[model samples]
Target: MSTTEKSNEKRCERDGREKVDKFRRFLAQFCATTVENLLLFDMGLCHSFPFIIIAALTGFPNKHNLNETLSLTPIEASWLASIGYISEPIGSLLSALITDALGRKVAMMVVNIPLVVAWFLMYSASSVWQIFLAIVLLGLGAGLMESPIITYVGEISEPTFRGVMIAYTHFGYSLGAILVATLNIMMPWRMVGLVCMFTPIFTTIALCFVPETPLWLLSKNKTAQAEKALCWLRGWVPKESVAEELQSLQRYSERYKSCESCIKKDQKCIHPLPTLAEKLKELKRKQTLKPFSIVMALFCISVFSTTFSMSTYIVQILKAYNIPMEPDEAAAVLSYVNNLGNISFLCLIRFTGKRYLYLTILSILFLSAAVICGYGFMVLPIGYSSFPDLSPNFPLENSNLGYIPFVCIILSSFCIFCGINSMAWQMISEVFPYKTRGTATGLTAALSYVLSFIGAKTFYSLETTLSMPGVALFNCIIIAFGLILMYKILPETENRTLEDIEMHFSDNSKKLTDRKIPKLDLSQIGSAKNNSNMPTRPVSIKGIDEQNNKKSGIGCDNRSFVADS
Candidate 1:
């Protein structure tokens, strides 16, 4: 080759290398943020450990000598299995206060305290009461962490990645459950608890390194810090690189703060604090009421789908169904399948819309439940009869039928994790407006846990009264109804920003008129005008048309004004 040609080729190679390096850096930056958010989600591991532990204790009492060691009664075992869910409501309520007052990152770290103590209590627990106490603490920690983490992820993630990020909460949970279940197969329950205690401690240490979400900082009126945090979260980019997003967050914060009534006496205000009745009236607004109703309904559907009940009672349920595999082994297998489903969800959510994916998943879930119910009826001779003492070990002639329940359970679990279960939590982070997100999420989550508590607490009784087949049939019906409701009302949220979502639920007649206009700083406007790099876009101001601007002698322009800053 000629010397000039060789030089040109070398230049081309250098250009290619630079482009590859740029892409790598971009990928690494987002990946770092994703990993940090996911570590926070490890709280789910602590949250789910109790359910699997209870399953192990009840499913293999003789193998683990828990009956001989603790003399636990069946009633006590049922309480032990279900009691955690009841405490979650209280924790969720407290989390709202903490999340709003202290900030999301602090709320997340504070929750780990209860989790660590709970695990320690479980490790040292001797009596049933001690175990009960541990389980309650577990529930408390789970509730306390739930709202803030979801809120944090939503606030920090890019819109393109938000669905996957929110869904990771379920991924974290399934991974945790799988770990605990696998551990149970190999070790004693107490030792497993001891090993699990370190997760929260490690989580706390790791959280100290992650930044508080920029939106929360902006809400607290820390503009510079919000910029810095936003910059770091976006991979240590320059402030100007994220200026557009930072300004958008600023607008949201300012809008919320402007409309809120002053509660502090020091902050002088002419308006009085809203009365109790007036405050209740505020909640009745379309923005708050609609999303709250939708989320609560979703939670109800999720709970009655038997997802939590199955998790808490998987071992017992499998044994009752006379599955071909050992109950513990089967439970572990299902946990693995659940994790796979969560992984599938994380992948599918990127390409599919939320409403369609959810509806499709629920449809499959209904079919799986129906199949389980049919299998139960076929194998059990005394179908739907109250037979609490029915042996799970089937005769040789019916052994082949055992695989049906096992396969059906695996499919049901997969569908639950892939769509209905994860989507409920994802919607919690998505549907609510920024101003009321913390309180709204807490309220919705608390009620959801209440439903879960009822479902879990009543599982044994329901199974006895309705029979195993009856329980499956009931779940099938609930899933079918929930699917229909969702089809009618669930809105598409794919690729939409938080503001767009909030607007979707707002009263159309009042949306434009009622929107609070944020007061702009004159200095920022001047700076933005002088800075050639700043982008300009037209902004619509309510009650200010082009003719109004012209009449006011402001300037000659189009229908919308430009707010470059």
Candidate 2:
């Protein structure tokens, strides 16, 4: 342990008097050097994918009067949309290849390459085909930013505040949305693209200055670099605590040889050091996928559904409602509400435990609200819908009910942020083995994007066929899947280590289902002074042989007492 880590750990454990100081210390360790360094969040990457495009383009490509404005054929607009989805996952997959190899700082900087070049291409575009070409480049670059950022952020953050630190990325997403909305109003479409061309440059600069992840360094067996990186991350924590953390890190180091020595000396599992790919293969072969994986899958499903089903088309739904203002004005208010929702949701997420119960509750509320709002718009056949008559100069005006869709939209987005977004990353970082984290994260991300493709394509087709209520009903169904998976599968993660989680899931499923399972008697457990008073037999292992003991005395009727734990 370094001097600072020791001091910090001592201060953290000094009874209840130093709690405030401990928190201050924790925050100091957690924050990055710049706003751009904080771009590693999945929310930022997801938001950036579409958000940057909106700011750069500054107008809807498929506006009803496309022929008059841009003289775009349906084919050109379709080309851009098609390229968006295709190129998105390309960058995402690229990030996985680069994350561990390049480190977070370099990865972030590297990702800006596609973004900058794409924007430069977009800025110079004078035709619809040229814009489509830019989108392909942009998607390739932005896709790399998506999954890798989540893994990088998770790698760098301290365990206690990791959840909150990751949640802050949603702020970046909100910022992108709000910034694009403003640009759409004040700037010419091409000028907007030109102005945004500088953003990636700024982002790239900040990323270059951030520290590499200590965990990744340790995993690579670079103990010295790991300690140095960790010190930068931990600020002025105590040396003892730092030492303890380092010792824990050393356990993961290939050079430690503890796992190997254990197998060789004690004739246990009998293994030596394995490559990362081998370790991941072992984890998969072991069927080490935890119950928590369900939580992750469900969250991704919800995010994927929200990504295209509501996020991109929400403003479309509002305009479809025939609101009182122009499409631009309607979008502005909706953007404000969406950002407000993100900020408030972030605050709420900090107070939430790892239990995704709140997520389930939010999903229910959002679905209910969506059903009411969408049903009102597309299902109920009210005359003029309390709106003004359609005309050449003036389109139909919206009812008060027109805004309710946004209300539902905002709250549902909050569910995305607090429920699915935070929980997915938190659980993935905590549950997956460090040896296999990179591969597992990469695999999960690829799966997520595949589903995102489904969501985007499904939402587009469904919206045209069924209208606004159909979209909500579709959302309601996806949210239902998330709620069910979360309720049954999410394990409590607060203050618990990954080992604890693994052990829980590794235990027999039937026994875990027992309503009145026994608890450990702390006083009787390893009490040297009262060793005589301790139970002579292990509670769950009576009459069971040590080898292949899954049945746990099921066939034995002797009821012989166990002698030790």
Candidate 3:
């Protein structure tokens, strides 16, 4: 034991500890940011790419003419515009299987393939059908990616991070819209479409380095892998705490699967793999149904908010209402404002609870849309002027009402972006128990997109028939219904653990299992056995030996314990 040798050993030990600490921090940081980035890349691009295409087409219809260039009539062009939404439900349905079977990372990868193809098709699109085909593929990618991406982010991030991670869906969407607005100004629509292809490509490459979600790994029975993944995710924590955290997730996984089973039943009887019908049945059992209903209501509100259609036809809608700015310029400004709103909401999400944020946003949107409708009603009698050549058959009576519609859209975009658009995605991830999350989320997405398809397809006709104000009024009513449903049904999930949320739904079952069972008077039984030293006598400890009193044999009935002497 030389002094020099001891000094060298101490230095080595300190260096080893430092290295371990650094690696742990690196793992934690990597897991948090990397998973979220992947989610944003997959979901945001898919969700917004179609919006970008529509933005460009709406902002510069004459330049990118389907009528002149591709021979698409008005009806055909409208159909083509909405066909992407038509295919979304199918993609959404398929995503449940993909996510459950292939894992979240792989599901995202598969969805990106279609999106890349869709972009390339848009780049080389020679006819309306080719464009339609491109959008259909885009819809597929968007549909499949939506549920899985939300689920993946929800499962990977801490509860504190889940809101922001889910909010990435909106952030990604706004970014794409901004890109479309800016790029359309800089280049041709085709080139912009080509440029969009790069996002999915780059994201796909980046995803290869990211780990799969620990929750999904646990669902697939990969306990070892799940522990490793969870450890890395919580790597900044002490090693012992990480192990405990992993154990908590495993327990949650088990309880989530068997929450519907009887409290006293043996664990083996609790069915871990429920059929779709059984899952649906479980959902109908009030406890699970409440959250499921709340999620659906939120999705419906978000989908029908008609912000998507407004974004798509921002130029036309603005021009129709006599917005003073050029349609292209107005579209770009609105897109930028909408992007800013999304960013603002993402930032605000970290500070607020989900319940308050959702209600507040929806209320603002409802009021804003109502004001727009009232203005439309008020202005109709006064005679208004709009861009003349834009819609000749629908002639404009001249007036300077342009600023009014422009301000309305700014307000509308701000409200929609700040509210339902981001909240719905975050809520979907927060509400569902992990056991049925993939299927439940997929169903919600499929239904929402179906509503979206209807809204997009009917939007032009609705505006033509009912006018912009009427459309706003229609949306206001839907928002009102959503607000009611949400207030009654939506639970506050902000900063709450997924286990806590699941437990909220399982309280009734927990009550049954947690009911106090009467304890036996073991002390009394012990005293009787010790004092009497009786082999044949049955000692009553609560009701354990009540049945033995009926036995006539020397030995007490086995239904109750017999004292041995």
lDDT score, candidate 2, position 371: 61
Model 1 whole-model lDDT (C-alpha atoms):
0.69
CA-lDDT, candidates in order:
0.69, 0.51, 0.64
Off by over 4 Å in 3: 1-68, 236-241, 257-283, 381-400, 508-565
**Compared with the true structure, what per-residue lDDT tens digits does model 1 show for residues 74-106?**
566668767888898999988888998899988
lDDT of 2 by residue, 210-324 (tens): 5677667776677887766666566544454455455444433332232433422322223556665655554552224653356456556665446343454444444555555
Which of the two, 1 or 3, has more TM-score? 1
Clashing pairs in 1: none
lDDT by residue (tens digit), candidate 3, 1-565: 9999999999888778656754554456445555445546445445545544554443346354444354444455457657878788999989987888899888887888888898899889886678789888988888988777878777776654556656656766777667777676676668877988888888777778667887778767898887666656655353464554454455445444543432223132334477777766654554455566766767678767646665555565666676777676777897778778887787887787667787887888887788777877776532222212234424235556657656867877887788677777777776666656788888888888887887778766776666666777888889888888777666666656564455455444333223121222334323333321111122112232333223311111110011111
TM-score against native, each model = 0.82, 0.74, 0.78
Descending-lDDT candidate ranking? 1, 3, 2
The predicted structure with the larger lDDT, 2 or 3, is 3
Q: Model 1, stretches more than 4 Å misplaced?
A: 1-43, 51-59, 62-68, 260-281, 383-393, 509-565
